[model samples]
Target: REKEEDGLETSPSKAECSVWEDLTLEKARLELNENPDTLHQDIQEVRDMVITRPDIGFLRTDDAFILRFLRARKFQHFEAFRLLAQYFEYRQQNLDMFKSFKATDPGIKQALKDGFPGGLANLDHYGRKILVLSPSIIDRYTLVDILRAILLSLEAMIEDPELQVNGFVLIIDWSNFTFKGWGLGSLAGSSGAEQDGPVGQMWLAGRNLPMSDVEALYANIPHKDVLQAVRNSIPDTITANLVAELCDFVLIHSYFRFGDNLYLQIGRTAMGTHMAPQYANIFMADLEQRFLSFCPLTPT
Candidate 1:
C-alpha cells in the first residue's frame, strides 16, 4: 500500500520474464521469429522470379502457396523453386489425380471412410498439426491416390498460420502390418520395369523428389546407436544385411540423442542439396515392420 502511494509503476515478476524467455526460445527454434513484412517480400521475390517459368507459372503464386515450398526449403529460393517445379511436374504426370482433385472427391472420400490416413484436428505442443496413417487399412485406395490425399491434406494444412511456421508431425501406426510383395530377393535389385507396382511407384515418386525439402528426421523411441549395437549381435547374415542397408537409408548424416529421441539431421551434398523429403515416409513404413521384428531383441 505504501509503495502504491509512492506512485511506483508495477513491473512484471521474475517468473513472468522467465516464461517470456522460454516462449521466445521455442519460437526461434521453430523459425517463427521471421518478420511478416520481410517474409512477404521474400515470397514476392520468388514469385516474380518464377512468374514466367513455363509450367511452374500456372501454379497459384500467392504468398500462402509459395510459402509452403519456401518453408520446406528453409526459405532457400532456388531450392524452393526446384521443389515447386518438381511438385508441378508430378501433378502434370498424374493428371487424373490433380486435374479435378478435391478433398471431397470419391477416391479420397472412400480412402478416408476406409481410414487409410486420418488427421487429428488438434495441434501438437509445438503448434504443428498432427497427421496419422494406418498402413493396415490401406486396402481400398491406389498408392497414387493415397499420395494425392496426403498432398492435398498438406496443402490444406499449409494455409493455417500455425502449421505454416511450425510444420506438422506425421505418425504412422503399423500395428498388425505385414511387408508383402518384394521379399529379400527382389529388394536387392536396383532395376526392373516388372517390379514397378504400387509400392515401387511410391518409392520412385519419393526418390524423384529434389533433395531440398527435408529438414531432419526425429525418432522418438529407443537410441539408434544402441539399436545398432544390438543389431550387430544378430546371427542371421541376410537379415543383418537387409537391416543394415535399411538403417543406412534411414539414419544418414549426424545423429544426436535428445532424451529418448534421436534426431537425425540430413547431410548436405557436395553440391549443397539436402536429402529427399519422402525418405521419412518410406523409412517409417519399412521401419515399423522391421521394428516389430526386433522389438524385444533390438531395433532393425
Candidate 2:
C-alpha cells in the first residue's frame, strides 16, 4: 500500500518496503512542523509513534508542549515527569563534565569549584519542592483580555453548570505575580497590573474567565480569570464578607511580616504574585449588584 502510494515504478522487496516505512515515520516525526495540520492528529498517532518509533515521539525537548504531551499519555503527572527529566538531563551533563574535568581550562575549573556553589543544583529540597508544587497556568496575551475572559467565565457558570454551584476558584501560585508581562518591565519585584487598569478596556474576553471548564483548555489558558470570575460572580450580600476577610487577612499577614510597607504595596505591588485588591473590588462590586437586583425583599 505504501509503495503504491509512493508510486514506485517497480516494486521493491519486502525488506526495502519495511525500511521505507521506517524512514517515512522518521521524517514525519522529525518534520512535525512540515504539516501544520499534523498537530491535530489524534492521540493514536502519538501512541503509535511511541510503540513503533520511540525516537519520533520521545525525541528530547524541554519545551512546554513536550511536557504536556507526555502528561497526556497517561504515564504520569506532567510536573513529576518534568522533575525527572530535569534530573536525568542533569545526570547526563554532569557525568559528561566529570569525564572531561581533567582537561577543562583553569578558569572553567575555578568557575565550577566543588561542583559550583551558585547553580540551580545547589537548591535544597524545600526549594525544589516549591518549584514542582504548582502547574503553570499561562494566559499569554494582554492583561485586559485575561481579565475579561475571567469575568465572563464566572458569568457563564450560572448561565451554565449542572450543580448550579457558583464557586469560582483561583489558585495563584507566587509565579503569576512574577510573570513578566510581554512589554512590561522586569526589575525583579514588579507586578503586571501596576502598568494598567480596567478603564478604557477594548473587549472583556481576556479579562473575563470562562464560566465552563469545558469551554476552553489549559494551553495558554487564562486560569487566573477563573478565580476573578468566581469572586465577581458571588452575590452582593456575601461579597462584602468575602472582601473584608480577604483584605483583613492580607493586612494582618503583611503587618506581621513587613511592618509599615504593608499598605503601601497594596494595588501597586502584589504581596504574593497574584493577590490583588482590584480583583477583589471588581468581584465584590459585580456580586453586590447581582444581589441588590436579585436578593429577596425578606433578608436571609
Candidate 3:
C-alpha cells in the first residue's frame, strides 16, 4: 500500500516537485482564476449569440421536467407526453421517414390530391385498422404466433392420438357432395390456410367431441353452398397454391387474434376473407381425421 501511494500528495507522498515548487500559492491560485474567468466570458459570448440568432438550437435537457413542474401548478396548457413523442420521433428520424414517404411516394401523392381530400380518409383507414386490431394492446408478432401455436396444437393432436385436448371435435354438415374435387373445395387464400393450409372445427373446444360430434355440428350449423363460388375465384392449378397461402394467412390471423388489439386486429369476421373460413373448416377436418397429437414441436 505504501509503495502504491508514493506520488499522492494528499496521502503524504514524497515524490519530487517540479516547476511549481518556486511559485507562491497566491500566484498559482491567481493564474487558475484567470483561466476560469476567460472560460466564463467565452461561454457568455456563445450564449449571447444563441439568444440573438434564430438559426441556432438550444438544449432540451431541462425543458420537460420544467414543463411538468409548471403543469403541476396549473400554469397554462402543456401536454408533455405528446410533446415527448413528437420530440423523440423527430430526433430518431421516424417522423422524418413518414414525411419523406408523403413527399416522394406516388401512393401518398395520389392519396393527397387537394384541400382535405382522400388523404384524410387514408389516415382514417390507418387509424381504423389500428383500432380494430388494437395493436397497442396485443401487437402484430403475438397475433401471428397465436396462429402458429394453434397449428402446433393441432399437429400435437395428430401426432399423439392419446394426447387430445379434451376429446374435442367439430362437426359441419356435408351431404357427401362428392361432386367436389381438388378444384371444388374452398379456395381460401393465404391467410385462411392452417399449417400449410386451413385446419379447424367449430366445436373442437367442447367436451366428448368425437368425429361423430363434429359431423353432427356441421350437419346442425347454418351455412350455404360454396363450391361454385370457389371455382370462379381462381383457376384450379394455381388455386391450390393460392388457397394454401390464403388459408395460412386467415387461420393464423384468426387463431392468433382470438381477441383484438391495435397491433394485431384483422378485418371483421376473419371468415369474410375470400376463402379463409371455409379453408379453416377443411383444415380442422384434416386435423381430426389425420394428425394424432396436438402439442408444439419440441427439441429432444
Question: Model 2 over residues 172-191: C-alpha lDDT tens digits?
Answer: 45465432333223443233
Per-model TM-score versus the true fold: 0.50, 0.19, 0.17
Model 3, residue 140: distance off in Å is 22
- Residue-wise C-alpha lDDT for candidate 1, range 26-59, written one tens digit per residue: 6634563445557888787777767556755345
lDDT of 1 at 33: 40
lDDT values, one for every candidate? 0.60, 0.37, 0.32
Please report how far candidate 1 places residue 114 from its true position, in Å: 3.0
User: Among these predicted structures, which one has the highest lDDT?
Assistant: 1
**Candidate 2 positional error at 2, Å:** 37
TM-score of 2: 0.19
